[model samples]
Target: MQVMEPVQMALPVTLPDDETFASYFGGENSLEVSHLKSAFDSLATTFQYTYLCGLGDSGKSHLLYATCIHAQERGLSTMLLSMREVIDFGPMVLDGLDALDVLCIDDVHLVAGNDAWEKALFNFFNRFNEPGKCLVVTADLLPDMLNISLPDLESRLKWGTTFQIRSMSDDDKAEALVKRANMRGLELSDECARFLLTRLSRDMRALLDVLDKLDHASMAAQRKLTIPFIKSTLQL
Candidate 1:
């Protein structure tokens, strides 16, 4: 297999804090992914399409990715395309891919105002919002708020079941950490976890960064992760 060099995008500013880092799907505890499953369950299957939207860190990508995984497991043919990678398809190519049994678009909000991509997606959606194929999209905001040059594209996206994920609560954050720790076979005391919650910022990405650092440190030092250890290692 020819391995292509990995693509990287530098953050515009400093990276997010520890708390926000841990909240993404596959980045932390998949246990909390049940939130997406419950939302999917409530979706009315009348339209052959759906849109899941929310702000960054609101779990939109997580839900779409998780649902795609679930549907694939159930023998559905799935095609998941990232806007960053596939935007070159422009409007014309993308407009014709309505035949897939399932289609999941990630970070579609990035393509919102692009003329070619917009026209393509809108046409693609028009063809797919029918009997069986489910065209699913995940974006950073509600359709009406997205700055797409093609106004029709916005309305088309808002056509089907739209579910939003509220910003997670303190309790949800802690539970997510616990679940991630357990998944990694690490033991985290409630006291230690709570300490992180209070001392650190609520950014999920930052939280995962700390946890990742802790994991690597624990392995190298062959030590148990205690509150003292975390305080000293991450300077939290």
Candidate 2:
């Protein structure tokens, strides 16, 4: 049997204006959200390194982007780097990042088992040891659980605070969909939101993508989001 390499997802490097603390629904991960907010609010955080681990669509990327946006709002130089986007660019892209007030990296587990990337990351960690520099990383797994090749890098990942963002319950998910639709200037009814939850993938990101489609369909048809309309538009 031939084993295929994991295909990295190409996420946009720019933080979407919609991705902010107010936009996020913490659900079971409220403490994690608070920690991220504090880290972004203060230049001198008690923990210089913060590692967030959670399954995809568990709001890990949301908090990371929120942190970047919050920091930028506070007049801090911020960069929201996606490892999946920059893994192809080589580790040289990590150079000159230590000067930033806040540096946030997403999908960091994508570099597991790569020697060059690990070395560069290890060196970057060492170089970013200044008192007020903050480095926040997100991955699908905890640092120790990742199949990292470099022990030094692995150890460095655990040097500071680590938190796991929890998946929301079904009720919370339904509320979140409605809230997101409201933010988009659309009204997503409770019944319609529940219908989507039952039919679509449980992943928040996937559900949000479907919501985008529904938003366009509703506008084009000049229709409210009725269950029948959703069924016809999405063929559910």
Candidate 3:
């Protein structure tokens, strides 16, 4: 069995905004996030809702964002709505469902935090019907486990292709780190990438923080990235 390490000293991870997702980690055809890609590709053809399920930092949001980009590039209209953001806007956002060909709602569990929101979601989804239109929802857990008070809404959430984000293997993460770093116009050596994987938590978001720190350190020191610089600065 693989041993999990505790995260390094860092603040809780913040989800990247749409721009950051697009700029930092564009999807690759051969990337190891294939589980997510296969499920979403099926959704593209079928116009069906798909749930991206995973534990925190399993890269669910990133995969969903990539799906949106892919959909847009195919000339399909797409909108990303965060459940946390929707809660503050009331149900008007829900009523405007006809505005897009695909709607992706992130962090659906936030609706479970309140009764009114769940009721609104149930009502909205019940009336939302458009031929060839799709809805994708992401949650920290499966719909059955979302703790939603509305049985109907809960059922609808569970009523689709559920794509769970696969946790990264050491090699998988090393590739991802190198890919993301390259997007930022930097080179990440295998040694530095593997060292980060060994010394840091396996959570991708936590791993991002380490990368961000290294980005700053590299810039501040005016040097190309090397494992020794990381070891000295991160004290690992």
What shift in Å separates residue 116 of candidate 1 from its native position after superposition? Answer: 1.0
Q: Model 2 reaches what TM-score against the true structure?
A: 0.84
Better of 2 and 3 by TM-score: 2
C-alpha lDDT of candidate 3 relative to the true structure: 0.68
Ranking by TM-score: 2, 3, 1
Q: Is candidate 1 or candidate 2 better by TM-score?
A: 2
Query: Cα lDDT for residue 190, model 2?
Result: 94
Tens digit of per-residue lDDT, candidate 2, span 1-236: 12222222225633335767787887324787777776644546543679998875678788877777777666667777899888999998987776776788898999999999999999999988776678889899999899999999999988878998777778878988898899999999999999999998987777888888999999999999999999999998
**Can you write out model 1's per-residue Cα lDDT over 1-236, one digit (the tens) per residue?**
12222222211223322222243534534433544344345334534566766664665654555556655555555566777666765555464356555677877898866777777777777776755456678877788888888878888887876766576666766767776676676777777777898999877657666777788898898888899899989875
TM for candidate 1 is 0.67
What TM-scores do the predictions have? 0.67, 0.84, 0.70
**Local accuracy by lDDT, each model:** 0.64, 0.81, 0.68
What lDDT does candidate 3 reach at residue 109? 89
Worst lDDT run of 10 residues, candidate 1, spans 2-11
* Prediction 1 global C-alpha lDDT: 0.64
